[model samples]
Target: MKTAADIIIELIEKFDVHDAGSRRAHGKGEHHKARVELNEAGKDIFGEVENAVVRLSNAATNDKVPDWLVNIKGCSVRFNHPLRPIDIIGINFPYFPFDSAAETLDVLYRIHFYLEDKSAGRFMDIFRAGGLYRDLGKILKWMPKSTDMDHLYYTAHSYGGEHYKMKLDYHPGNDRIEIYAEKDEHLIDYHPGPAVHLGSILINPHSTGKEVKYFDVLNAPPGMPPNGNLPLLRHYVYKRSFLRRMEEKLLDGKDLRMLEEVWAEEKYFVLSKSQRIYDEIRELVKKGTDMSATRFRELLDEAYALKYEEKHLRNYLQHVWGHFKDEADESEKAHYTRLSEHPDPEAVNTFIHDLAIKYKEPYILRTTMVKTRGRS
Candidate 1:
């Protein structure tokens, strides 16, 4: 049976969207290493936020479409946390037409359809489900028309279910904002919304030598697991898109460091699981041992098993909490249920991290996800 995810992948392949399985929908964009400080209000919502990485892209019809011509803009912010990082994704428009990922996929179809047919009549379908269609004004308003991101208001319409819903908004900045490079976090939240200001993004540009880093769309904060059909299908598209992009980069002989780092940290063999095994191998190297292929293979296998345990254990704790809670003592059960239902946003990741690292020490690593910038 062709599930929604299967259909999404098919559409991605059909249009040959460059950034399909990644960035949610913002494929063509720039990434920046940003410093995020919470305002008094923001601090209340998101405590002690570390600096972050941001992706700013044009939510245009295609890669060839100009940023200003696009009706929407996409921004994804990833706070720097060794484990259990938070990802807040949003668009320039105040509200998204669709409430879920499936709706977003429909928007994608509408976009490609409009582009191919070059007909507003088709795109402005009154019967179109969710987004733009029902609101004729919005349909025209959200067409690609932004002059630039500096003055544009980008919003994160993300919901961590009912328990954790936040409004992370960016204020409208002027030409001076873009004119000056490396604008700090305070400049744009220069405040964008009614809610607490959610820091600013310093869009980092890359030149010849610099490396381009990408945020992992899969890594959602605890208590905010992106489950359900929409997320499933959306993630499928993201994964496939990323893999395709990586493959293309490989073929083009582009630097693969970023991909390697993403895989090491985010993918199957995460840093925590593999780092110790790597350290063991390092010790072998320091001792001047032969370090045969068999030994290396064994270490990799160990890392693989450890990673499997990490994944399965996380799943078990989050989903099968009821069964385990039944067996545990009162305090343990309460703790499990509290976290399972409504977790303390600040502590959940650390708690999960502690559990995952019960045997292994936490592995903290950083990667530029790029190389050099502005090479002549």
Candidate 2:
């Protein structure tokens, strides 16, 4: 039986072939480097790096990368492999800057600029602060679906002689599959969607003994394709069973209805979660509680865990907390009059409760839905 990895590989190969054909039809030949010149900032930042090449192509589709691929131009990067001795590191993006490849290049240039000045730590700080990922998510939420071939993007990084490859699979759904690999070892799989908290699965699927070991891709000698053909059948079986049991409980009428409502008003839930934290903080203020960042995070974390009851909620709660803090700070300056940053809690709660009558929308709405159903 073909594993998910095999399916992914086949999809990628199909995309490449289709893309090549499209380019030929358009009278455009593949260029070793993109035609658009990087700005001064891009040149300055990427100048120090050897063999960094960027390419813009419309071949990327919503199902394989960023869902906004239809509205935005997308690009991929190739550079020296950071952790491995491979000739190139592939950097893929499911989504890039909206409507402009130039904008995408600018963002990459900005990232490199920070990297050059302060190294990796500052680079990441700037990336997050700039709202790159958040903005991408917002755009993705509204963009039309792409009808093109699905493709995977590759980006590489290196630290302490360790090479890491990041892949974004734009499968058809609200969420994308994010894969992180170090050398030949698959490290992490991140799926972002309604059950986002249940999506982070770590695996070392190829170890012989009980001790899970990471496997390397087949790109060791250069010019060889990366290999993801690990013995994943057992791992898949275990995960399927685990998910089945979880879903049996979580997707029953009552629970499924609640989840459906949550998915429907996901935006409201995020806002309400933030507002509730602020309301609690206001009450705490009355009790002379310290409104320090530490305390704020603690309260938000507690509330999020209580409501979501999933392990991955913490990751999102942190982001929400950050937004809350910013909103609170603005409210302090009288820039906002509302006590809460979100809508009324009663209304939000009622909206969720009302969803109990509408549970037939879809039980499992995700790219992995078919795979899970097949196992059963």
User: Which candidate wins on lDDT?
Assistant: 1
Model 2 over residues 72-114: C-alpha lDDT tens digits? Answer: 3233333333322222222233222322223333454555556
Worst 10 residues of 1 by lDDT: 367-376
CA lDDT, every prediction? 0.44, 0.31
lDDT tens digits by residue: candidate 1, 1-376: 3445446655666676444323335655666666666556445444467566666667553566666666567666776655445566555554334446567667668766876786768667523856354566654664445456643333323334432323334443411111111111221122222343444444334322333444443455433443233433444455444544443332232324444444444322323345456566555434322323244434544554552244333443463233233445576656666665554423444443433323222232121110000000
Each prediction's TM-score versus the true structure: 0.55, 0.20
Candidate 1: residue 253 Cα off by (Å): 8.9
